[model samples]
Target: MSPVDSNALNELYKAHLAEQQRRTEHALQRGGFDALLIASGIEKFAFLDDRPYVFQPNPHFKLWVPLIRHPDSWLVIRPGHKPRLVYVQPEDYWHVPPEAPSGFWVDHFELIVVRKPEEALPYLQVPGTLAIVGEADAALGDIVPNNPPEVLNPLHYARAAKTGYELLRLREASALGATAHLASQRAFGEGRSESAIHNAYLDACGFAERDLPYGNIVALNEHAAVLHYQYQDQQAPAQSLSLLVDAGAHSCGYASDITRTTGNGDASFQALIDAMEAAQLRLVDRVRAGVDYRDIHLASHRETAGVLRQLGIVKMDEEAMLAQGVTSTFLPHGIGHLLGLQVHDIGGFMAGEDGGTIAKPDGHPYLRLTRVLQPGMVVTIEPGLYFIPMLLDKLRATPAAANVDWALVKHLSAFGGVRIEDDVACRETGAPENLTRDAFAALI
Candidate 1:
């Protein structure tokens, strides 16, 4: 990874902070609140166990400052006033304490350091109606977070549009994820076990398993059929047919999600992978301001149907296949989703900033995003075609089964499936920026 230009980042951070303040002030006013309080969230212990699960800071808090590890912290924001951060740097012999707040963002906030979580209460006694934002667990005594929908709706809706600072971090995250992807691809080529390939990915990115934006899908062969493939086998398959790696990296608080598939000397399956790559790129090109995301998802179905037909798997025209629901059997998941602080970011289906929903297209229940594309929004264009036995078996009982070449399906099922994903950013004019592609291209 390249060293970040701190001077440039500092300037971006300033602008980003300004925008956040503007958004929060608007939300507070709209919700009839004098101030907004955001908690960094507290750690929780596992059921019947002393060990705590990895703490994930509130996205609301992260939007203001890039403090992901700190817990029991609070942010106070009121219109026309500078934001206040009640930072906690607990004194403990069992764990290393959090460092004092520093960096370009610190100066913008009124810093209030406290040794214990309760100590920060004195600073939070601001006048007027305060809307607290955070999980109920993070509430300090009677000051539980209300999490009013009126305030959150607009804020969540507005988060879809990325600030310049957020885009920079997202790009860096893509580069870091791409580096790990290259290493994992090599590990797969060398016939490494699933666990080993996952390790190579982490080693290349210098990220612990917990640091990842989400769990890595290090699937090999038939395992790829499972969309969110979770487990990693320690033993290498006797003969690896294919490997599908869906992994990502985080920069600051933003995340980059990318996926790639490789075939092991299978000429026919390799062709399918190539075809899917082409189809995915076409879908990526379709992303821009004003286009409905559901249309892109529907387009993906058409593309996947075309691949099945061209490859002799489905013996029917694309339209007939789609009408018979043949395409759904192969591509079960959505074409893509919004991407940012969360992997499947919030507000993908939101009607507007005031809060309503844009329903997913009929029969495409798995689609995650249904909003119209807009400039500054980032989304994933992931189109996949899989041959899962469960779905295929159901298809066999239907009349549409006659249109499918079962023989070809049997042969390709060994390779599991093919999915190519890239994170794309919508723009106001011209073409949308392919963040994943550009990051990988830079390596060459």
Candidate 2:
């Protein structure tokens, strides 16, 4: 991986902080509050065990600063005032404490450090109505998070558009994730087990499993048919026909979600993979300002139906196949979703800052995003074609069964599925930027 220039990053962070401050001030005024408090959430212990589960910082808090691993910290923001960060540096031998906050961002914030969580409460006392943003466990004394929708609605809606600093971080994350993907592809070609390929991905990215943005989907052969495939087998399949790796990496707090499918010397399956790539690229090209995301998803279904006809898997025309719900059987999930801060980011279904919703198209309940594309908004375009036994069996019982070629379906089921995903950024004009492709191209 290429080294990130710290000097450039620091400058970008300064601008990012300014934008965050401006947004917060507007949100506070809209919510009729004088102050807003965001907490770095506390860690929770496993049931009947002393070991704590992984600590996830609140997205609301991390948006202002890059303090991802630190918990029990707080950010106090008041309109027309410099934000205050109550850094908690507990003195304990049981675990290593967080180092004192020091970075380009630290200078912009009014820094306050204490030995315990409760010690910082006095400093948080500000005049007028103060709105807290965090889980109930993060509350201290009488102070608790109300999570006012009036304030959060606008903030969540605005987060869909990435800042310049956010775009840079997301690009770096894509490059890192692409590097890991290349390593995993090499491992798969060498006929390694699913667990081994997963390990290679982790090693190449230099991130522990717990540090990843989401659980890695390292599936082999028939396992690829399952979306969000979880477990990793220690032993390689007797005959490896295909491999589907849906995984990602993070830069700072931003995330990149990517997926790739590879076939092992299977000519027929390779053709299907090629076809899916073409269809996915077509969908990615449709991402730009003013385009509705739901149309892209519906287009993906049409493309998948076309692939089926081209492959002789279905004899019916595209229109008939779509009307009969044949395409839904092969492609069960949505084409893609908004990618950033969280893998499936918030506000995809929100109508506007005033708190309304844009309902999903009828019969497409799993679709994650329904808003129109806008400049600086990053999303994933993933179109898939799978042959799951359950779905196929259900289709067999329907009147549309006569249209499908069951023999061809059974043959292709050994290879499982094909999914090509890329993270794209909508632009002001012309074509949208393909971040995943650019990251992979850099590897050359």
TM-score of each: 0.98, 0.98
- Where is model 2 poorest over a 10-residue stretch in terms of lDDT? 1-10
**Top TM-score prediction, candidate number:** 1
The residue pairs found clashing in candidate 2 are none
For model 2, residues 1-444, the per-residue Cα lDDT tens digits are 466588877888888888888888899899899999999999899999999999899998889888788899899998888889999999989999998888667888899999999998998888999889999999988779999999999999999999989998899899999999999999999999999999999999999999999999999998999998989999999888899999999998999999999999777888899889999999999998999999999999999999999988999999999999999999999988998899999999999997799999899999999999999999999999999999999999999899888998898999889888999999999999999999999997
Predicted structure 1: clash tally: 0
Cα misplacement distance, residue 216 of candidate 1 (Å): 0.4
lDDT values for all models = 0.92, 0.92
Kindly list the per-residue Cα lDDT of model 1 for residues 1-444, writing each as its tens digit: 466688888889999988988988898889899999999999899999999899899999998889889999999998888899999999999988899888878988999999999998888889999899998888887678999989999999999999999999899999999999999999998999999999999999999998999999999999999999999999999998899999999988799999999999788898899899999999999998999999999999999889998888988989999899999999999998899999999999999878999999989898999999999999999999898999999999999898788988898898889889999999999799999999999997
Candidate 2 segments whose C-alpha is farther than 4 A from its true place? 1-7
Task: Provide the lowest-lDDT 10-residue window in model 1.
Answer: 1-10
